[model samples]
Target: MLVERLERFFQRREEARRRDYFYVTEVAKCPRQIFYAVKGFPRPPLDGQTARRMALGDDVHRRIVNALYSLGLAVAAEVPIPENGLFHGRADAIISLGGENFVVEIKSVHPYQFDQAVAGPRRDHYLQLQLYLHYFDLQRGILLMENKANQELKEFLVERDEKVIQETLDRFRNLHRLIFGEGRLPPIPDKSDWEYDQCRYCPFREFCLRDATEPPQDTLEERDTVPSEGAPEETPPEKEGSGKERPAPRDPPPEDGGMEEILLFDL
Candidate 1:
């Protein structure tokens, strides 16, 4: 029983590690190619003030949704697309009026996200909104930004660009491949242009970026040694174990070895 538990524990650990690696790789690769890739960026744990603000914004958005519904539009708030691998993205406000549907992405940007959108551009937001648009089969969407100054809401209507949509989809698929192909993370780019002010907030920012300086390594060495997708297993045999009848494999496990049990010390 003890041995079985220990084996299961190790297996779980292996699976978790693989998942973590895949996540990092996908996060690193997706953004440049897919405009909406930014939505996939791992969020930092919010502080008390930020958390409260986010909650309030959510409430405000919900209220705005209610207003939309009252205006006699066939509205759906926080509607989800289940067919897309449980993509938990919620459209802040969805309106189907005059036989046309519109996906509304509401943002409570206090000039930071707003400024970034104005200057650097919010590719992630565009990509995510586009994805939502695609799922709903809608060619039009809106980016609603809340203004604290006027206590009024401003809306930006975005028409679906087939080129942008198709390109973003392609990038997403490639990112999916980079993640699940070998269950490993991609290395950070050296010349990672710190164009986004939000880069300072990224956890991997330390490794991928510096104080307005390019990383020492311009490009990561492509390690051919690393396993590729659908590649044949090249795992080596145990150091001292021999032959076809070699005992199950070892205790505590070797670094490169897999889940196959090898009982080192006989009971």
Candidate 2:
């Protein structure tokens, strides 16, 4: 019982640490879930096991980034990847190698995730790194996966796909306008969609299902979006594989050893 209480306390503290901006990871999550989170709807406390797992994951991030900083490869660890003030996310590290820099994204995953993704990086993970590559204006990114049970690691390289970046920007931009600008909640994604597992484990599952305040709008009703305040209209992304040189990798010493970071995109 005492352990359970401790886990609950940690869970609450973690929630309190979450800032108001939609995180970069939001690109890979269901909008309705994001809606429930951003709206501050009440939900049950996460169970002890899940809470412990999450805390452990944060610890792993610290350990890995610290090691990289020591190795002289990491220019910056836990670098913020922000898209205007409305969206925020942190990349694991920015590493300089062979006179070039690449975005590094870390995942502490179950061993099964490794076996399942033997072919290549998972789509969601790729997409998350995609955001990092484009926002950081880097030509390439690396996905680093560490097996939770054994700490075994694998690395995958991804190139910046300007087209995908454009699509995601459009998607997140519209979501921002709908949720904050129009004063409307995001429509529920189709339950049959591949990523619907988020709905199953969602804390607000019952509330989301029972309250159909707005019918599901799969298209996100882009026409209805009013540009959000202080959010800038974005320029077109650079072409893919242009072989252009971006600004060199930032050469910043890792000051703190933890995962806290702050970066913003001007809107």
TM-score of each: 0.56, 0.72
Please, what are the lDDT tens digits per residue for candidate 2 over residues 50-120? Answer: 55676677888899889878877889987876557566777889988777898888877767666565657
**lDDT winner among the candidates?**
2
lDDT of 1 at 242: 19
Residue 28, model 2: lDDT of 63
Task: Write model 1 residue lDDT over 1-267, tens digit each, in one string.
Answer: 686565444331100001111211122232321121221222223344434454666676777778777776637887765455323345676777567778877666554445434432245455667777777788877766665434455555676777776775675566556545543343333323222323323333333322222112322232212222111111112222212222331221111100111111110
169 Cα displacement, candidate 1 (Å)? 1.5
lDDT of each: 0.44, 0.61
Best by TM-score: 2
Worst 10 residues of 2 by lDDT: 229-238
Hey, what RMSD does candidate 2 come out at?
14.3
